[model samples]
Target: MIQWIIPLAFICAGIIAGLIGEKVIFKKLKTFVTEKEVPGSDIIFQALHRMTFVWFVLAGFFWAILGSPVRPDIANAFQKILTIIFLYSVTLVLARLTSGFVNLLVRRTEGVPTSLLSNLAKIAVLILGTLILLQTVGVQITPIVTTLGIGGLAVGLALQDTLANLFSGFYLVISQQVRTGDYVKLDDGNQGYITDINWRNTTIREISNNVIIVPNSKLASAIFTNYHLPAKEITLTLNVGVSYDSDLELVERVTVEVAKEVMQEIAPELIANEPYMRFHTFNDFSIDYTLYMRVSEFFDQRIGKHLLVKKLHKRYHQEGIQIPFPIRDINLHGN
Candidate 1:
């Protein structure tokens, strides 16, 4: 009964100490998280909430058991159990921290997602922790490692498609050719903003809000144009035709004025230093020329075209600039 009393007291004391430490650490962490507002503060707070008191209690429990008089075999078994729990807890904590850090990084980087990498990191941590635990408890892992090595080649062959996609995803991530928020067009006429690249597919969101999922392996091999690269700004040309009788100088002046107005009102930042037109062709109907302007990106070109056409037509109407249509003259001879 006396022996039992001492052990019971020690165990209770350990639990109480753990609870106290938990509250104290949590309070401090809360303050720090609130004050600092770091990227992974929530993850750190949760980790501390679980680990701080649990570790203290585990330590106290171990101390209590060691201090009590017990058989050597029982003591050894208890110590092994404690060691396994400690290892498991440490692995869990590390995995969470790693995943949190990765999530933070994902937010900072473009075109990178965290789910796949975070899960992979956690799995790796658990596998390593399991192996270490097994070794600690007198289980040999060399045989298991050898077996995995031998089977890896067969597994690789069986999962050829899956492996290809996985490697392609890795390559896409490293290349940075296509990135989030950038507009891209595939050779087959599919165009959209790249949203994410996961283990098997890359997600692109089109202007219509529809998502296009292309296999990572295919995306890696496909020839595509990235409009956001080199620069986000793009040049757009609008072909216009004025009647041959109209004055070319007046036409250029009116067109340039309207373009400058559009630039200032619609896409001031996107337009190039100058808006100009070139008289390039003479047809049977009207003189053909091309109006050149710049836009912020692919999407902006649509708005650019709309505004320029509307304003140019209105201004042309006011200035009496004649836009001609194709006309054919039919003549007949009588004998």
Candidate 2:
């Protein structure tokens, strides 16, 4: 019991000191620094917390080794304490540096790249820490490294498709072919605006406000149309039919004028150029005409087309132009 007393006292003292430090020292430090408008109070708090952990670890180490057969001399004990403190200091510095590095990388890139870089940094730090701990515990890591290499090869082979998608996601970010907020049409006929590009998939928000998650593997392999790239301007064509009795020149002039007017009224900024009406085909019921116009954006085409059609209907009715309806004539032979 007497032998255990010194060790127990050391531990009790450390705990009491830590409590006091947290309550008194830390509080005073916070107040002083805050009153002075210091810039790094948060960092100081983090360092203090780390130092408290160091003290606790050191106290336990001393308690465990005090009565051992290999008990160190006073000078040796002091040296050992210094070494422990040094190691703790080194670890703290390394941790802070690694954290700063991760934050810097995260701030520099966005989307998939930032995620990848941050994850990679964390994994590297963990691996380095494990290696250092192993070495400290007198374990040789050569065999472990070799085994990990072999295991990694097998894992890579097993997860080839997954890795491919990951790499493809990175490629997409680097190439800037598609990004959030771009309107895209997938090969599978899904059309939507890109909401997010993540590690494994891209999220798309449809015009109906439904969200769709598309795997990077499928996106990388599929042919997709990005409507927001190259330019936002797009050509939209509306097919209309008028009765054959309507004058061709009058039809073209009225259609063009109506389209331009509607575009100007609804979306004045969307009209990239003057609208034109073209005679496309002669159908069974009426003459098919195409109204071609350039809009500032693909989405505007929908609204522009709707408004133009409504205006065209009103104008055609006012001008007495007949929009022919399909009719089938049947002749029955009397038996």
TM-score of each: 0.77, 0.58
The sequence of per-residue lDDT tens digits that candidate 2 reaches over residues 99-177 is 5455454445532234444444555766777677667656799999999999999999999987887787777766878
Clashing pairs in 1: none
State each model's CA lDDT, in order.
0.84, 0.74
- Which candidate number maximizes lDDT? 1
Off by over 4 Å in 2: 1-151, 330-335
Q: Write the per-residue lDDT of candidate 1 for residues 36-99, one digit (tens) a residue.
A: 8776778777655667777877887788788788898998899888888888898888878777
After TM-score superposition, what is the CA distance of residue 306 in candidate 1 from its true location, in Å?
Answer: 2.6
Clashes of 2: 0
Whole-structure CA lDDT of model 1 = 0.84
In candidate 1, residue 64 scores what lDDT?
A: 74
Quote the lDDT for 115 in model 1. 56
